[model samples]
Structures are given as C-alpha cells and as structure tokens.
Target: MSERVMSGSVDGLITLEAADALWADLTADSAVPTASGAFTCSPAHARMGYVLLGGHAVTTVSASGGQWSVLEVEVRRAAAALNSVGMDRRDLVRIGPFRGAPRLECDEETPLRWRQRIAGELQEPGGPGLAARRAAGRPYHLAGIDWRQMLVEQTRDRTQRTWWLPRAVVRLLDAAEHAETQWVQTTRTRQAGAAAAGAPAPRPYNEELRGQLYSVLSRKPGTARKVAGWACAVCRTAPAAVLDHCHEHGYVRAPLCQSCNTQERPDHLYSNDIRVANHYTRLFHTDTDDWLRHWHRCPGCRARTTLPLPHLAAWTAHIACRSLRPTHRAPRGRKPCGVLRVSWTGSQNTPRSCLITVAVDCCPSGEHRVLAQVSYREAAERFRVWLAETAPAVAAAAGPDRLDGLPAQLRPVIADTDGEGLALF
Candidate 1:
C-alpha cells in the first residue's frame, strides 16, 4: 500500500485501516524486522527523538509518544525503555520519518505494565537486559518514564546471575553454527578451488556463504530447521553463528557470535586460545563447575569439604539475583576458596606427556593438604587406528545444558512462566 494511504489522516493518529494493517502484518508474522531494517535518521531528523528506535517491535512503538518524544537520546538508551509486553502496541501506531518508527504513551496503563514487565523481563537476549544491567550497576533506562515522579522498583528482589541462556538468542546461535557446520562440509569441495585459483580467492563464495548463513541466524530470522549442539567457541554464552575459517584450510576452525564475529580482537582470541588449552582444567573459572567440583572427593585430591560450592556461585543466577554468599571469611580479603596452584613435576616425562602437581586448599582454618597432579603435553597430537566421528543428537535440548544440584538462583527454569524455561533454547 502507498505510504500516504497507509498514513490515514492528517492528525498524527493513523487511519484505523493502517492500524489494522499493522496488526494484520504482526499477527501473521512480525513487524520488528520491518522497523529495524528501515531504522535510521539524518541530522535534520535527529532532533525529533529520531536517534532511538521510534519503535522496534509490535510491543514497543507508539503514536502519543513518551520518552521518544524527547528531542534527542542515544539509541541503546531508548532500547532499554522499549521491550515486549503482554499488551499490544502495534494496534495504536504513529508514523516516523523512516519507513517505520513509532512511539506510544497514549495510555498510562501501558507504561505501568511496562514497568512491571521490565521487572519481570529476565529473558532479554543479549542480557543482562535493562533490568539486570541496572542490577549490575548500570543505569536503568526508562522511556516515557520520568525518574523524578516515581519510586524505584527493582525488577527482581534478588539479582540473578546470568545462567539461563535466552532461547531466542540460542536459536539464532544454533542456526549460525548449523549453517557454518554445513559450510564446513560443503566447502571442502570449494577449498582447493578457492586456494588454487589464488588471485580472486573465493570472495564471492565467502559472501554468498555469509548471506545464506543468517537466514535463521539473523536477528529477525527465517526457518530454523536445523540446530547443532554447539555454543559460541569463544563466549559460550550464546550459540556460535559465524563461520570463522582460514582461507588456506577451507574447513572451519570455530563458529562465533555476531559480536565476536565482528569484533575480532587479538586479546580476546588469544585468551580464548589459552582458555581452550585450559578447558579441561575446570578448577580455575567462576561458573558453578569450578566451585562445585570441590564439594565432592576427586580421586586426585580426595579431601571432602566442609562447605557447599557457593556453599559458594549463587543460588542459580536467574530473574532474582539470589546472592549466595559464603559464610567463610577471607582475613586479608583474598578469595575464600580452594587454591589450585600448579607446579610442573619434571621434564624427563614421556614424549607424549609431562606431569604437573597442583597444591590444593580446602577452606578451614589452618591446613589439610590434597594435591591434584595431572599430566599434559606442551605440544600435543594424536594418531588413531580407528577414526570415529560424532554428530549432535538432532533432538537434543537446545536450551542451557542441564544442571544437577545447583542452587535455584542459578536456574532460569525455576522462574519460567511460559513453560519453555527447561526446553531447548
């Protein structure tokens, strides 16, 4: 339909038909992608609160306007104020200069409900969402929201650590990884061609690969028929989507997220390499695994502990930031946890591996010694008589991996009102 016709009336209020058309489009599919694609502003329009998303989703736009009514604000700042709500905002739409941009505040009920929604908005992808961000010492963004007239309502009484990976993001990550995994298989044929041709090198092939890669991988995606049980090789927070391959080797090295895929940092990648080297060593990191592992008897350092792991991380970092503080106190403010100190045993070890000794400390007053000594190869390689390959179970759960005996605070599934909390992401 023509923009003029869709606009309906001279007054800012959209024609009932335009509103109905928007509702129809949203009900059948979604208007989010339509708005996002066209979301932009020139300096002239920037003063009309155009820097922010006029409205990004069916739940977020409006005609009466609220904070978006302000002359200027950062986009991300405005995004904090905008989120999905139980009620619909697409039905009452106003127009912005771009193909789509709309803000809503026609009713006080929406903003009040919005506040309640933000408090409960724990599943925001790219978390901690605005709520969690505020809990983590970031400003709580409110649009159409005036801080002076209100009292603060913490989204959740307890601050939940990031444990549950948002299924929406996970779905995107899964597609990206699956597409790349397919690329890994398909490009084997193209590898020699691209490498041998040398000059132009598969630029077109690479572009085409990335373009097709985001069908389900895009922010607003298409069909997601496949999912690989893979997390981002780096952050592991979300699923890996980008296929990072060396041009010389046509096969893929790692699949990454949109953020990591774009911001190729040497330090972060280098840290990832080290993290990979130490991936098997589970005692150093902060996830529940590191603290939890110390609870039971390890064959290496069979000392039983007096405390639980947050015994030690939190109660499961969920909607409520349930801070599970340990009773034990550090005298000098050092971390009151086990000491996983490592020392190499000797150089005369076998050609395949060498030994290292770990000095362990189970937290009590003075000392009980339990040392875990393990082996590794400075440079490692493997030769196998039998070659076995594995693929992820097609029906495997795509949500966060299962946790056993962890605190309820860490469990996002505990707060699931929609029944999808425990299911695949």
Candidate 2:
C-alpha cells in the first residue's frame, strides 16, 4: 500500500469539535477499538506538541499508546473541515515526519507579540514568512468569514498562548494593505498634477467635480465638449452650450446656458450679471402679478388700471420709476399692503431729483392710499421727526413681555422690532 505522511499545524488552536471529529475519523478505520477509540494519542504524540508545552486538550482522550495511523484522506478531510471555519495550514508552526513529531513554536503568544511580528515582517523588503506565504496560497472555504475574529480566539487552556490562523484570513489582510497603498499613491498623483497645472488641490469628497476640473485644465476636447452639453451652472434649467470663465484669471468657471451667458455688462464682472439675473428671477417668481401691473404704470395718471398692450409699451418707454413690493405686515382681516417705491427723473434743463413714495391699502377702507410722496431730502427729514416723536413712547411700552392692548399695525412696528427699532422704510 502506498503511504504519505500528512501533517500540518493550524494557524490558531483547534476547537474540541474539530479535534474530536478529526480524531474520530482517523481511528474509525482501525480494527481494534480502545477506550478513547480514535483519540488514543496524547498532546505530544498527536503532533500537537504545543499540548506538551502547557496547552490543554480540547477533547478528552483516555491514556493509551499514541499509535493512530494518519491516512492522506483523513488529513485532507481534517484540513477541509478546519478551512470551512476559517482555519488552515497557514496556522501551522511546523509539519514533518510523523515519528519525528511536528514543532508547535510559540512565537506570538499574546496580541501585542502578534502585532509586533506583523509590523516587523511588513517592514522587510523580502516576502512574508512561511505562515503568511501559506495563508496567501489557501482558498477561502467560507464566503464572508470575519477575518478579525480568526486573528484571535479565546483558548480553553490558559497555559496555551499562540494559535494558528487560516490562509484565507491572511489573504484578506494582504488585500486591505494593498488597497491602502494604492489610495495613497492616487492622492499623491492628484496633488502633483494639481500643483503642475496651477490649480487648487481637489477635495477628497468632491470626486466628480475634481475629475471635471482636471479634464478642463488638461484641455481634453472630448471632456470639454461633454461638459458644454451639460445643464447650466446658474439655473440648471437649460442645456449649457456656452463656456463661461473669468477674464482676469484665465480659468474656466462653469458652463452657462445661452441666456445667462448673454446677459452681461461690457465693463462689469460676470458675477454682477449673475446677481442681477438671480434677483429678477426671484422677483418674477415671487410676485408675477405685481411685475405685470407695474410694467407700464402712467406716472401722471395715478389710478391703478391696466393699459392696452400698444399703450403699455409707450407708457413703459416714458416711465422712470421701478416699482418694489412692500415688506410691511398689514392689519388683521385686511388687504395686503401696497407698493413702496422710488422714482428718478432728469432732463437737459432740469436737475436730477429722487421721489420716495409709499402706497398701501388703508385699513377700514379698501381704497388705494398714497401714504407719502416726497423728495429724498424731505423723506429723510420726515423720518427723523417720526423717530424723535415715537422713540420715547416705544421705549416706555417695551418690556420683557409682549405689549398687550396695542393696534396690530403699531404693535408690529414697536414690539417686533428686531433690535434695530421700527423697520418702516
């Protein structure tokens, strides 16, 4: 009969169940049955010499001459079972002749020792030790075994320090180390590239934007064309075919749609155009009716009436005022406050003059009320007089509590002043 010596150390200590199963299978084929049957070997004779070095047996075995035959088939079966639970030959300290006995070297007895060994091994330019090499070669039996748990296990015997680990667990650790190295390399490359291109280093989180910026800086035709076809940076409402950039600093800012790109002043910065566009966009969406109503209001005829399209066009050409929406609160159970605006007019013969006006829907009456219409100087003077007259009454009424029994309009002006006093414009 052809015979081959089959022996290897587990990376970590073996469990009772694994040891029992392995011993049972090995001696099952024996003709004579002892009291312990298959597990008739001591810690030393069984090739697990670590037991002799103070490690306790996981499974109970009767005292008998350790003469169990280790068939190649039985050893392979034991290896497979250990692998299934994330234990493999990589965990072995030594494996040789059965009679000579395998050496269970106890180098890394504690977690601190294991860590130190790993660190030292990694620092070496040469390949890893025998344990690491075997681990890398072993196949993963279980799909997602927790490699960390395999690294350390609680021993039943306090005397036993070092244990074996599976090859699969070692392979996982190798892969993790490789990934970290690759990430460091990639980050350094990006920083170098950014510095060469005179661009700011990209943030780690903004991967997409960083890539886009790199493409722009490198002047990649395909990427630039693709970027130009993307949605507008300003509104994101239309396809941005125009590439916008700062004239002073020659770097591409962003792709803006045709409309946004076209609305710019000759001498003013592009940011000014963006601000104006944003203001109008907000105004148009917020108060569409107000925009249309004031589009062609005749200054001479103060009535709130809509004009025909043709007349409205003419009226807008003649008008010098821009109407603004009121921000003040109206009395409860009343119509909303009306337009508060300023107008300016000048001619060859006339000096430039500003007209500040306030109009509102007066309480107790639904009629349109023009509260004030005065020159800028006159408005300032009136404001000063109002402040002087109202400051003392406001200070007297103001307390730690809400002012009770005051008119809604006056209460908002006094009590709800946000530390800046009455916000009436």
Candidate 3:
C-alpha cells in the first residue's frame, strides 16, 4: 500500500493576540491589523469569546458559506484571557515618569507597577485608585468608549484576523481540530452502538477506498489510496452514518446507513448528489474528461474496481473515449485469442505489461481471413500517437496560435504510421 505523500508544511503559534487577529481578519470585512503579531494564541481563547474571538472565517473555497464554529470558540477563549490579565489603554501612562516634565507624583520606574496597575484597573469591576483601577474588573465609561470596555474590545479585536495565519498553518490547525473531533465522535458512537447491540465494531475494508476519498478532499494531487486514508480519517465511521462511495470514474455511489442496510431495505442504494458534485468540482480543472471514462461501470460494484479513486493521468486517458460507441464484438466463428504474454524493456522499473490480442479467422466458409495479431502495447502506443496528433487540432479550436499544455503522463505514446492521427496497430 502506498503512503499519503506530504505536500506542504504545518505551522503552530502560542501568542494569544496573534490568533485573535487572524480569526478577525478571516471573518470580518475591512478588518484592521491587531496590535500584536502572534498568529494563533491558545485554542482556549476562541472558546470563551465566541462572537468577538473566532468568528466565521472560511478558508476553503467549498467552505465559504459554511460555518466554522471551532475558530469562533478559540476567539472567545482569547477574550477570556485578556479579561483575566487586566491589560488596558490607561496603563500606558505608567511607563514614563512625568511624561517629559521634571517629575511626576507617581513613581513610573517599575514595569511590574505598570503591569499591576493595568491589571488592577481592568480586572476589578469598579475603579478604587491608580493601583486598584488596573486590577481585573469591568471598565468605566469615557468619550463613548469606556477604558475598561476598550480593553475588553482590544482582546476580541485581535481574534478576527483569520487570513493573517500562513496557509499551511491554517490547514494544519483545521486538520488538527477536524481529526480530534472525528476521533471523539467515532469512538463515542462505536462504544455506544457496541454497548447497545453487544457486538464489536467493524474493521476498515482492506481495500483502498479510504485513500480515494482523501484525494478528493486534499489540495495535493494524489493516488486513490492516499485520498481514501484522509477521507476515512476525516469522516469517522463509528457514527453509523450512511457511507458515500465515490468511484474513480465521475460517478459517486449512494450512502448506505447501517440500520438501513440491516433492517430497512438491504438492496436499495441512496445517492448523494452533493458528495458527487463536491468531488467533481475539486478536480474539475485538473482532469475533467478522464474521470468520466474510467468509472464507466456502476460505482456500487466494489469488487470490479479495487481502488476507490483513480489517478489523474489514467482518468484523463479514459475520459477521452467515454462517449465513443463500441464498433463491434469479435466474431463467434474465429478461434478465441487468449491473453498475450507481453515482454518489455521498461518492465523492471514500473513492472507493467500490455495484454495484446488481435482478430483472427477460423471459419470454414473461406470468408474469414486473418485480420491482424498486434500486441496491446502496440495498440496503446498507437493510441498515444493518435492522441498527440489530434490534441493540437482540438486545442487549436479555441485559438490557432494557442499552445496546448498537456501533462507529461498524458503525452500519448506515438506510433510510426505517417502521424496522420490514425489508430493503427
């Protein structure tokens, strides 16, 4: 089994203010920068200040209209921290002695004094004195903005900058939260179900379906196996929710809830147009045509297709001929051609061979004649050549001068037959 390949990096931060700012930027329009530079403070910050902290900030294109509650939770928690710390605007004056004047009535030589004074005024509910005012409390009103209220406001101000975090960091954080929640949900559901039914949980299918799902979700281009793993992990199965099976081809199979499978209608399958649409959109620009061709059979037939999803290159090749009608079947009178034993030079590296066969004549009427005996490799090579020749013309339809940028894996295996774009083997 191939492993999921890492396509990017992960980022983490401890600064509370930074997290708040990032949360704000992502959710709010015309958002300003936070006073501090931290990207992601503690997750706790988001939980406490729900509205002020982590608000709605959708990073994924698909998630744009969806709500991201976890981010909001983190922001609220950050506000809680600010309230606990008692930092406010008035505390700035405590930094200098007399502010360029000869001397001030208060001693401004201590940083601890400033912190304490600031903390006292903000932390306490009411102001007692210069020192008592800095303690944690509700703030007093001034110029339509109470100093204490402003202090509380600043904490939330930082949480709104969601786009401030690096792309990798945002994904990693999102993944972490998703994983944690999924795991918890899966574990709890399985435990409850097992207790209720007195049976153990089912194991993952030994097949590569899990990896295929991951490919659809992840930004990285990948094989079916890699995609399946991520998809499985993201959609924890212990919850007894219906399963959505997606074929490498364009089709997505229906969801089969456990109870529905066992009790209601065992033979029935329910399709989820949303999942299919989502998968199609993700790789639409990447390999639109190929996927349509490869997944020709009904997606429900699990045994026919081993991997859950298809490689972009292979899918691309398949999609080109999806709409073509079959010409004819082999004549019954002809002796059946068995699978050809293909030998090739590149066999050691990729270790794959083409199954070759050709039409032959075995009829007594003398009408049957030996048509050909070409190897599948020859057919494929010829097909590739035809693809290359016609691709330019096809691409030219948009504009005669425009160059077609085909992927390397799809640079059709050309044939030697006059390059007329004909499929001759």
Candidate 4:
C-alpha cells in the first residue's frame, strides 16, 4: 500500500499539500523527492513535515514497538529541514496549522485570537519566536504582505478591513508604533517643562553643539565628530554606539561601540603623543658609551670597565672579569709591545686586578719610551724614595709652594720641613 493509504489510518489527520509545495520550492535546483502524500494529526508530525518541506534532512530518530517506525524518521527529517530554513519548533507551531488551509482568516475574532495565544507561548523573551519570524521566507498574498508594509497599509486603509499577517509581524508593528508614540510624548513633555521654567526652548539635536561636549570630555578636538559613522574606531567591524572621550578632561576621542569602549580603561597622560615621541627618541638615540659605563660596573670590585661591542661578548667578558684575573694576552692573537697586570687592595677589603696593554712607539720623534703599571701602595713608596734621593732637585722642579698638585695617595709620604719630619718606612 502507498504512504497515503497508511496516513488514512490516523484519525483527524490532514493531508500535507503545503509541505509538498515547500519541498518542491526548496529542491528547485536539485532532483525533487517523490511525493509521499503523508498525512499527520500530531503537532510534532506537522512541525516536522513543515521543516522537511523547507529542505533539511532528518538525522535523529527513535523507534518503539520492537520495530523501526518510518513516521519518526520523517518527523526528524522535517525538523532538520525547518532548522535549515531558520524556523525552529516555536515557529513551526505558530504557522503549521495555517499551512494549506482553504481560507486565510487573520481577523480579530478568530485567527487573531488564536495567533495571540500562540505568540504568548512562543514569543516569550529570549525565545526563538523573533528569529523564526525573521527567517520566514518571502511573503505571498495568502500569507499577507511584509509586516512593515502591512503597517503602512493599515494606516492608509481607512475602511478598517482586516488583513492576514503573521503573528510575529503584527507584534513587531505594534511595538514600533508604540515606541514612536512614546518618543513623541517624551519630546513634548520636555518642551513643556522647559517653557514652564521660563527657560528658552530646547534646541533640536542637530542645532545643539555637535562635538563640543565630547571634545571637552575626551581632551580631544571637535574634529573627532567627522569620523562618526556606523563602524567602531577601535575594532572597526562593530557598529558605533557612543562617542568615546576622556573622563577626566571631557575631550572627545573617537567613536566606539559599547564592547570596545568598555574593554579597556583610558591611557595615562604619558601615553600622549608628545611624551611618547620624546621617550622613543631618548631610547633609540642614546650613546653606547654612556650605556656601557652605567651598566658595566664590576659586581665584585665596584670598578667601571669598558664593555665589548656585542651583547653576548660583553656579558661573557664581564663574567670572566668578575670571577678571574685577566691572562694579559691580547684576544684573537693580536700582538702588543707589553701587557701589564697589577693587583691592588679595593675598598671592599679584597685584592682586585686590572690589565693594560701597551703598543710600541713607531715614531722616532716621540720621547716617551715605556709604559709602567703599579699599585697605589707601590707608587706611594716609590715617590718617598725618589723625594729622599733628589730632595733639592724635586724642590726646584716642583717650586717651593706648588706641591699641592700631588696625588692624595702619595702626599703623606712626602715630608714637609714646615710640618713634620720624614720617616722612611
């Protein structure tokens, strides 16, 4: 027997001619499925059939009575089809009965009352009613015109003749009209209040100071209003919601959507253009010698040293100096006239060593022939010995009153006849 014969077994069930039409429209570009001539009384079956007509496949199914039921499979497929058309179960429930009806009745008495009841249950806040209505394909004369067009017609139609419209559409029209009326009333109320208070009539939004308020809040220029548009300045994609401004300065910054505006706090004063530019210049234009002197202080001896050019080499050189004495050999086999390594007692009460390399004199005209390195103590003792051996010559060379230029470390070793007697040690 055919599926149609089997459908007749269910009582009060109606044939689905509307579903067949939907299926045909949905599969217009592809091979059409063979008509099943299915009939259904259960709301679920009706809903599923309506969805299937929209061209979605059913994947989920349940079986009972020790046998697989084709009805359940068809219902699931119908549901999937409805989902594909963006209509959910709520939408299917609202319009399923109206499908393929002999007459379209949307008057206040019968259909409106029924539509209202369905809308109450289906269009609850956060429900799928709005989404389904939005997805309701192109409207036919039978289904009535689009809701916006219907609202315009309602205003023009003085006869008060009732017309069929989707319940969702009717609700939307009512809401829009209500909001418009409320806005008008609010504007009138504000105007009356201003007049009663002996104040000048309030200016229209266009006549008011455009971006002055925003500029003051954000510490920005009034030109920011020029960038006002649908897209947010920060994120670029989201729609703009408000003019972003500095809360402290009251200057307008830029247009930002709600999400972008609330995502981060305003930047500090140092983040401004002038300060940022100055900082960038200082960072990039700094002298290498200054940086080396500042950072290459010996951790053990507290003496400053020249740092190598490469950062890795500089670090390695620093580490080696901190822990070990220099080998007095020129790096990479570079030859030198002499290498001097001298050890001295540092302020930290530890022995510290330094290395100096001397180059040979190439010019015959030069008088200095040697470079000498000595510790502070050795230099002091040598100065004492030299002063004793050549007292008269030293006195004549330095002049009588000019010994003040002597180093602080060697001054005490030179005895002044006017102050104290010499004690050679």
Return the top candidate by TM-score: 3
Candidates 1 and 2 compared by lDDT, better number? 2
Quote the lDDT for 354 in model 3.
Answer: 28
Candidate 4 TM-score, C-alpha based: 0.14
TM for every model, in the order presented, reads: 0.20, 0.16, 0.21, 0.14
lDDT of 1 by residue, 230-277 (tens): 444545555444444322112223445444443331111110010011
- 10 residues in a row with least lDDT, candidate 1: 381-390
Off by over 4 Å in 3: 1-165, 197-250, 254-310, 313-425
lDDT tens digits, residues 335-382, model 4?
A: 323221222223111213322212223223333232333333333334
- How does each model score on lDDT? 0.27, 0.31, 0.27, 0.29
Better of 2 and 3 by lDDT: 2
lDDT of 3 by residue, 1-425 (tens): 01111111113222233343443443233121222212222112222222221112212111223422223334434434333332223322111111121111221211112223344444446433443244332222211111222232222366431112222222222333333333344555667777897744544433333223322432234332232222222123532233333322322232222322122111101110000112333233343333222221223222222222122212222233223212233576533232111111231112144222222222334343323333334444443444345443322222222223211221112222211111111
**Clashes, model 2:** 11
- Candidate 4, residue 31: the lDDT equals 20
- Clashes (backbone N, CA, C under 3 Å), per candidate, total 23, 11, 74, 16
Model 2 lDDT-worst window of ten: 416-425
RMSD of each: 21.9, 33.4, 27.8, 35.6
Report the lDDT tens digits of candidate 2 across residue range 1-425.
Answer: 11111122233223333443544444344321211212222212333311110011121222235422333343334334333433343342211011221111222211112233443443346524333445432321111122223443334478433333443444333333333333333455577787787643322221133112222443544544554446665556555544543321222345555445543211111111101122343323443333232221221111112222212211221121223223345566533344222222321112136343444332334555554454544433443343234343332333324334222231111111211110110
